[model samples]
Target: MSAGVVTRLSTLDRFLPVWILAAMLLGLGAGHVIPGLGAAIDAVQVDGISLPIALGLLIMMYPVLAKVRYDRLDTVTRDRRLLLPSLLLNWVIGPALMFALAWLLLPDLPAYRTGLIIVGLARCIAMVIIWNDLACGDREAAAVLVAVNSVFQVIAFGALGWFYLSVLPGWLGLPQADLAVSGWAIARSVLIFLGIPLLAGYLSRRLGERARGRDWYEARFLPRVGPLALYGLLFTIVVLFALQGAQITGRPLDVARIALPLLAYFALMWTGSFALGRGLGLSYERTTTLAFTAAGNNFELAIAVAIATFGVTSAQALAGVVGPLIEVPALVALVYAALGARRLFSPHVSGSDRVRQA
Candidate 1:
């Protein structure tokens, strides 16, 4: 039997794209039609970070982190077949691929190109979980991988930002782009946006489980807080698009341009990872986890960094915002693609069985 994971989503999740689109339009309209709205939003800042936007980002990250079974990380670490390939895909190949695509596709638009590279550097620590689960992937693997990503994101994101944006391009004889923000600045943004949520989620999971046990934590507590991720995501998008509404509306083709490379990146990454996993003899469920996790970008951290580094109205921020606009639907479609590709694996490897075990 198939996992039927996608069928289990609540109504709000089923029509997520619609709600996001509506939020985008609403923000854009409010920004364009209403004067000073963006300013009003920007005026409220804590330590130079927009308060509302910061809140939304924190909310977006927390529940997803909370859902991770950090305890299972030891198990994942022992599985070098899975862990090694995932590290190579996420940190090395993923960033290099995006850098190449950004330069090739958006050489002229340095701002957006750098923005895309930043997206690549910020690996998915949030929504990949849902995509993995929906694709009937290994749940333990997904949680552990995401936790690994969060840790790597903290330690390496700034350095990768520097390498891709400033160092590597010069080495390749391409026009070197300035990241503008210092490494410390990028680190600060990642720390605030990711670190806070990471600690909160870790603590929540630990304390919640200790107090009421794992069953209540996962079944009762998680379901309540889980939706907050998307809610925070939508809220942040509205605020972001609101700030950049005029610019986004003015340059429709630019958004499309940013999207094309992202589309290529996702397709290439997912397919490549899937093939790699199957060739490595991973089960269908593990392969699906590997593919989705590899394919997904952490747009929450991307947007936060873009906005924190470059103001919300900048083209860089716009590129970061377009990430989820494309990723949500793209990855959702890939979920189905993964489900169909299940037959390609050995008949002995059952996805439903793996899901049940996870």
Candidate 2:
């Protein structure tokens, strides 16, 4: 890539989250004043699914998947310590904590609380890449983690859904849970969202490798797709937030309440995973990469499933939508924090050290 292209890519990487948040606010404001705009946009459904929103998410997930180096799966699998922490944080600890927080804080709003759990359970799909890059993480390891998480999510979503409804309530001091999420519905959503993008990305990569050189593929195609993916994600967030603008205005405090647990979750996961990776004697990059992989959530999939399982008007779906609103900004901050802390921990000679030693 040319210096200018590389510079532009870096700039976009820095500010994409800000742009997403701006799009969401702008869309929400417009939807509120325009009254029926959100409804009309949301009404553009196909086969009982929101076509525009779904397309946006699909487009958003494409770039992340496109970067997956499937051949490196063996290398990642060999790192059992990294994989174990990721599984525990994402599947065991993350989901459990989210359920407890949702139930405790949103006692009266079952749908919203349920939506939060759904989002948490879905795990990281896209933003992990951005965070991993920001933290200067192991690129190959991050790619393999993404692929593994995608595969596991498809297989475990149904079982997780069942556990969320059947088992989570008792642990949280709540009454019997009665949420009805069909296994088939979870399976279909996973297949349509996660499976399609993964296959498409894999096929595209394979074809690009055959047709064009790796240099051309990375420099020409990958760079182009990265920003497009972020744009697509932001656009979807805009539409979803717009659709629920009125509710957000009415329950502004609700955002704060939900954000508390999310913040806690992020901090705990990031710290725990980072410490674990460090104790295992992994490099700084691998540690941060694994930390972010464990910390981020695939909110897009969560929102999609929430809307499908519970009506778009339901607070559950709205809660799922709200996650990205808080997370985009929070994660951006975490990205910078991770990057800034690198010099302090990295064994590689710091620039200042080199200058002083010189």
Candidate 3:
């Protein structure tokens, strides 16, 4: 990369928080100014998947996946130690933490509690890359973890949701009844949001390289196409806030009530991820990647599943909307925190070396 481009990229990274907040304000303002705008856009869905959300996810995820070194995937498997921690954190610890937090924090708000847990269950697929990038995380590791999480989300989300949302509530003596969500329903959302983008990113990277050359593809194509993901993220943020702006505006206190547990979840997960990575003596890059992969939530899939099972008007879906409203800013802050704390973690190592050590 050219010196100028490197400088520009750093500048972009630093300003990401500002841009995201601006998008939120603009989206909220536009939603209030133009009545029914959010509803009109949100109503455009196919098979329980919102088309705009799907598109935004596609744009956000493709570049990140495209950058993955597919050849290095084998190395990831061979050195399986680093992968286990993140898997445990993502699937086991993360979901359990959210479930506990939801019930503990929102005892009376069952639908909202369900929504928060759903967010936890739907690990990162789309925006994981942005957080990883912002934190200067190991890109290859992030890709591998994201792919793994996507697969797990498909198989586990429905059952876990049933276990937590239904069985747990009744088990805890809550009045909420058990609701069974079809596993395939959750799978459909994953396929639309994650599966397609994974395939397209792989194909686009391969074909573009074959057609043009490695040097041009890496230098020209990557730089040009990379920022599109951020744009897509900004667009997603706008739409999300636009959709839920009025509700948020009307009941700001309620929004704050819903946000409390989510904020706690992010902070706790990031800290634990960092400590675990360091305890295992992983490199700074891999450590940050693990932190983000575990910390970030796939709000799109969560929102889709929420609406499909709970109805568009349900508080469950509204809680799903609140996911991005809180997550974007929280993750942005964590990104900066990770970058600043990078030096404290310890000796930087190459990806291969880090994988081997972990």
Candidate 4:
């Protein structure tokens, strides 16, 4: 709220929660007021994903990825302290925690519970990048962690889905659900969502630096394009909510029921991950990266899998739809939380501090 902080953030960055809330409300209003809005938006699909949503994600992600110091990626990969903890938190602790929360919170609502578990299994490969960047997390470190997650996502997602939705539930004497997901579909989603923006960002960084030098690219080009990331995010939120606004409004109680576990999951995962990172003696940037990556989920993939396996009208799919509705606002608040928590890591200057000092 200080002028110093206000000056440090772009108008879009400063009022991010406001913009996101308006976008969500706009999408919901438009969806409710305008007939066939969902159909119109849903008409154009890229392998079952809405084209507009896909474009928003690509735009949201590219600039942040472009800002990564790719040359320093080797150093990030070599840091076992960061890499190993990230892997464990994302793959092991994250899913397990979600599974427990979903079952514990939604015991009677099996379909929603299954959907939340599917959400849990899908570790973040996309929006976490934007959140990480917004929170002033390490760019190189985030890029590496994201890439690692994408690989694990392609390899482990279905297996984990089975383990959680079917295996583990069965072991516990709970009613089990089957997740009939295609490996190729999962692979394709990862390729399209992560692969495309990653390629664009890499090329943009590489060529921009080569042509204009690192100083020009970082100082001049990045700021110009950086705001686009948030623009894309807002657009995506509007479209995402619009696509399901009618259902969301009609089933307010159901949406609230599904939202409870998700709220708990994000809060717990982010706080725990941040604490773990600090306990491991990581810097603020890497710590933020670890926390965001661990806390975020691939909702796009979760929705697609849920729709593909269960009908779009199914409770499972509705649970997937509720994901970003809760996530966008919750994580935006956490961005501020991460910023405030930076003071706890004092004597350890943050990316925002470096920019302010510069």
Candidate 5:
């Protein structure tokens, strides 16, 4: 049953890049072919946020949250040797690095900057499994990292993302950011976007297991719904690009502009994290896991949160779409790099040991 789940996830991850691009094209096409359709979608607003976008964001986040078995959180603490470094790399250093890079790279484009910040704040949610597995990293450590990150993405991603938007600029004495008009603005946005899915996902996991049994929940039910986030992603992408078609048409170069910082972010984070782990003389298995985890981002949640906070047509939303465009191929390349570099680890840490450790 577990094998089946992993296989399905692997297949889905492999094809996700194609679907994201398709969604981008579809969105752009829909806007051009049917301007009225884009207008209609643009007209959708409820309390400053689009209803369809809110629903799509909910769909994108709920499955991710529901799939996490928070019950295993105890084990994460037990592996703090591995877990602690991952936490700092993912939450502390990763976000800071992306923020600095985004500011330095995209000085004039605040929306795109905010989007990159969102991506930075959100650590890998699901796809890191494929990344870690491909790199032959430690699966046990991956599980611990995933469990911890799942909880943190909910509790911390919003606050820290807001910090990047609202507080960091002031602290760094950088130009005032276009982000978060006020603290309450981001607080409200977080409640609607991240809060709802978090509650629903936790309750669904607990209640579904109680009603149907754990095996059914993980093996049968989760596999069924896990792909809904992607569906939501595609739908949201279609609507967003459709709505912003005119803007995108005028500024076709903006896509590439947004993508560059993200590409830089992935390369920078992977190398830095890998070096940090190796510098500590950590096992290759654990170091590889950290490298992948630190490099990956939960763009699903980031996209949802961006659209929720900014408008569907905002540059922030555009930044969200650009993330997957770069992350998929970049991480794939990193997988090869990790595999090729395996021999450089301590002689005591063999490939066979990684398999057993994972």
Candidate 6:
């Protein structure tokens, strides 16, 4: 990318999340004032799916899959430290912490607590890649980590979801038997939101590489798709928040409660992954990449599954929506923090090297 292009991308990276939040606020206001606007927007559906939301998620995931450097997967096996830490943090530690926090902090609200668990159990399948890249993570390592997380999410999400809802909640005091009933619906939503977009992106990249050359694929296509994905994600956020505007307005404090555990989860996971990366003697870029890839949650899948499993109006679904609102801003701060920390600790590494390492 050219200097101007890189600069523009960086600006979008910083602002996209804010823009998403703005769109959500605007949509919420519009939905409230216009009376029927929320229902009208809700009516925009295709094959029992919400078109605007589905389109947003579809485009949002494109950039993530676009960045997957499948060519580098061979090299990933050699970096076992980075790979292992990423897997453990994302799959094991992150989910466990989220489940624990949900039980401990979330009040007796059934839907809200379930939603938090859903968000926690579903590892990030889309925007984690963007955060990882923005943090100046190792691109090759990031690509591999994203792919690995995607696979694990597909295979393990249902089992983990069951554990969090059916088993963990009972251990506390709020046991719910209906948790198992949502599995099939959750699975289908995951397939639609994650599986379809991933396959389409991968196939398109493969075809584009063969027909249009790597330069065209990377320079011409990737840049165009990146912002589109962010816009789509924002649009989805708008619809989601608009639908839940009343609930959000009434339960403002709930957002803070949900955010606290998530913030703690993010800090703990990022720190643990970063420390593990440094202990492994990996380069700064690789360490940063692992830290973020492990820390981020796949809100797209979580939100979709939440809506499907629990009604869109359910508190559980609302909690899933709240996740990104907190995560986006927090992650932006973490990116800056990562950069500064990297510079402070590894002062010998030049700015150019830092960028390259990312």
State each model's CA lDDT, in order.
Answer: 0.81, 0.72, 0.79, 0.90, 0.73, 0.72
User: Worst 10-residue stretch by lDDT in candidate 2?
Assistant: 349-358
Write down the TM-score of every candidate.
0.81, 0.83, 0.91, 0.96, 0.65, 0.81
Per-residue lDDT of 93 in model 5: 91
Please write out the lDDT profile of model 4 over residues 1-358, one tens digit for every residue.
3355546766678888899999999999999999999999999896687899999999999988888888778888888989999999999999999999998999999999999999998999889998887778898898899999999999999899889988888899989899999999989988888999999999998999899999999888988888889899989999999999999999999999999999999999999999999999998889999999999999999999999999889999999999999999999999888877877775655343335212
Residue 94, model 6: lDDT of 86
Q: Which digits, one per residue and each the tens of the lDDT, describe model 1 over residues 164-230?
A: 8778888888877665455565556657776788799889999999999998998789888878877
Best by TM-score: 4
**Model 2: how far residue 210 lies from native, Å:** 2.0
Better of 1 and 3 by lDDT: 1
| lDDT score for residue 193 of model 3 | 74
**Candidate RMSDs in order:** 4.0, 5.4, 4.2, 1.8, 6.5, 4.3
Give the least accurate 10-residue stretch of model 5, judged by summed lDDT.
Answer: 349-358
Candidates arranged by lDDT, highest first: 4, 1, 3, 5, 2, 6
RMSD of 4: 1.8
Off by over 4 Å in 3: 1-9, 171-176, 345-358
> What is residue 293's positional error in candidate 1, in angstroms?
3.1
- Our tally of clashes for model 5 stands at 1
Q: List candidate 6 stretches off by more than 4 Å.
A: 1-9, 14-18, 107-111, 168-178, 181-187, 307-310, 344-358
Model 4: lDDT equals 0.90
Q: List the residue pairs that clash in candidate 5.
A: 139-358
TM-score of 2: 0.83
Q: Write the per-residue lDDT of candidate 3 for residues 1-358, one digit (tens) a residue.
A: 2233224344555578789999999999988889898889878988656678778878987876776667677766655557999889998999999998988899988778888888888898778887887566787787788878878887888778777777777877876545557778767766777788789878877898899987787777777777787888898888888887887787787788889999999999998998888788877788888899999898877777777787877888888888888889998888767766755765556542211100
